[model samples]
Target: MSNSKLYKGSINTIILKLLNEHNKMYGYEITQKVKDLTKGELNITEGALYPALHKLEAEGLLDVEIAKVDNRLRKYYKLTENGTKETANKLEELADYIKTMQTLINPKLA
Candidate 1:
């Protein structure tokens, strides 16, 4: 993200939401997809992304698949059952956060 601090807290939620929508994705693919979806307004870096992935895996919110493509192994991530549920909850929380922030920023938006 261009303004990563503002977005850092939502990285896991973002990852889960994207995995929910796309089913499965590799690390670089996830980065590219986020970039494309946000029109480059957000950029997920390796420093930020992998640790989040590992954390989700440790939390049992994600599953990893390893596949060989032309002698190179690639790691793909997908949402687990718990992850699906979490995604919905996180999205709702994010939406509510946006609404609250909007209200605070501009009471007319409330």
Candidate 2:
């Protein structure tokens, strides 16, 4: 699968899960974390990352704090109380999806 297409489906869950684990992270940090975790399999582009961050912020699932990092302004994202709950739900849903895909892909084994 194309990296763009794969990220399209998993970006939100990935973002939320990262925030859940790390408490807070900036955009570039999040992108780098994904790369590190996936060992370069998943690359998150600015085009996709910013929009998802905006959507999540608008939906009240994320809280943003702007800060000066070195010589640049950076916006850090963290999960709101609601976001924490939603993260759990999203993770559960993702797990279910993986299970379903696995079953379908290996029905004989299943």
Candidate 3:
């Protein structure tokens, strides 16, 4: 039973939440932050990350800016106005989902 399957569904929310907290972040930075926060239990792949970013950007929930650092162009992401609203909505939704899952996993805790 891999935890990846469990986390896959929530990746978007995770990304949005991180951006909300940090103001802005690059893709690799996002991946590393998650891994560090999870104590290496979770690893976010570029394959899963970039496509999600693209989708979010396309949906107008995210804004991208390019900066040249160390002579290389790096793309950074930040939440747009809509994204900030969406982040709040997603976080509330996630809290509900987690509560439901917790009740299912342990009725005594409910």
Worst 10-residue lDDT window for candidate 2 reads: 1-10
List candidate 1 stretches off by more than 4 Å: none
Model 2, span 1-110: residue lDDT tens? 13867458888999999999999999989989999998998889888899999999999999999889898898999999999999999999999998898899998766
State the lDDT of candidate 3 residue by residue for 28-93, as single tens digits: 999999989999898888889999999999999999999999999999999999999999999999
Look at candidate 2 and give me any clashing residue pairs: none
Pairs with backbone N, CA or C atoms under 3 Å apart (clashes), candidate 3: none
What TM-score number comes out for model 1?
0.95
Q: For candidate 2, what's the RMSD?
A: 1.6
What is the TM-score (0 to 1) of candidate 2?
0.92
Ranking 2 against 3 by lDDT, winner? 3
Question: Which portions of model 3 miss their true places by more than 4 Å?
Answer: 1-3
Error of 1 at 66 (Å): 0.4
Mark the 10 consecutive residues where model 3 has the least summed lDDT.
1-10
